[model samples]
Target: MSVEPKMPKCWRKESKPHKFCPGCGHGLALKALGMAIDELGIQDKVVFGCDIGCSLLAWDFFDVDIVQTHHGRTTPVITGLKRANPDLIGIAYMGDGGGYAIGSQHLVNAATRNEKITAILVNNTNYGMTGGQMAPTTLPNQKTETSPYGRSIEETGYPTQGPEMVAAIARDEAYAARGTVANMRQLKGFFKKALQNQIDGNGFSFVEVLSTCPTNWRTDAKGTWKYLEEEMTKFFKVGEFKTPAAKGEQS
Candidate 1:
């Protein structure tokens, strides 16, 4: 017998029957985020900033104030919002394309500057909302709409490892980590920790969630889950790249 999952009261009941694809992983990531907010009782104090792509669909999903921003612009907007109102919890929800490609500079600068905000980057490898194109996070030699002959690392460079990149800065007090939607328990833990870091007035917290794009990948639910577990994890090593304790601060 299966049991119903406990949902967060922070979720909008009117947004039920979400618009994500059948095997998409965005739902799982969003659920974990929502539950984390609910657990921390910060539902009303949150300012969710969603970037272009599938992540923008979450603008109405949360009961908290949400704003949909242009492609690769969510981070700066959230950072500015947090700076303007330190009392508000700033969250940047974005897909791989928005987080790794055009917005990567903003991400790096925000981390280096120690912006007090939380960023959740859902990496589905390909650009799901935009015809499954080759995103910066796409695995090497992975076939996508733009990489029909498989991605050529020789020409395209390596996939963007977000957590590792952000964690490499020794002086920054940024908490960086990576998790997968396939692993709900671990994913939720990562989400909660990232949120708690912000609540504790930490500099910056980032969580990269390895997700699936079934509709874009042309895979069913089962196949998509398998890909996320076996294939995706091979390229994106899941772990806590850095924590607040590493910076000698309690998270």
Candidate 2:
């Protein structure tokens, strides 16, 4: 007898055939998020907040309550909502541009404040939604719509390591980790741990998902996976930056 695959109840079955581009990593990230919610049995308590950009398309992907915020405002909105309702699990989903460039300050403030929230920062290097512009996390020499001749390190500077930055300001109760969609199991584990941190009332939890934008990156499916594993992984190393377990307590 063959066993059927289990689907996450948190996902809206009607929302099948998501709008994400072919080989896009957004779907993987969403799947991981949904799985985490189901595993933690917090499907009813998750209040997802998605920022403008490609990430905003996830507004209706889940069966749980969701709010779509303007560009660079996802973090603050989720933070406020979580503060108002302490029993809810607030989640902020954002793209590289929304999380690292326009909303960089908000993200830093939220992490430093140790707000009871879980942030999923999807870093695909360039801005995937708006014609492949150079994002704050865009790698040096990477060619984008804005950086036609390849990004200049001296002029554009280096990519921002979001997880490391958040970890630097996070307290012992907080959690920070970096995982890539290239490693599906590890990525889901990171998502689950991040959600658990918030559910445990341990303060803030930040997870950076190194994803891919095949359409914008001008690559096919295989190339996308190769790029994520070879190029992107070199700059944004994956691993947990901080965990509650490090403080002699279970995470």
Model 2: runs farther than 4 Å from truth?
Answer: 1-6, 246-251
Q: What TM-score, to 2 decimals, does candidate 2 have?
A: 0.95
- Put down candidate 1 lDDT per residue, 39-148, tens digits, no spaces: 88998899999999988888898899999999999999999999999999999999888888989888989888888899999999998887899999888888999999
Q: lDDT (0-100) at residue 130 of candidate 1? A: 77
Give Cα-based local distance difference scores for all models.
0.88, 0.90
TM-score of each: 0.94, 0.95
- What is candidate 2's lDDT per residue for 22-102, written digit by digit as tens? 888999889888888888999889999999999999989999999999998999999999999999999999998998889
Top lDDT hit: 2
Clashing pairs in 1: none
Q: Which ten residues in a row have the lowest lDDT in candidate 1?
A: 242-251
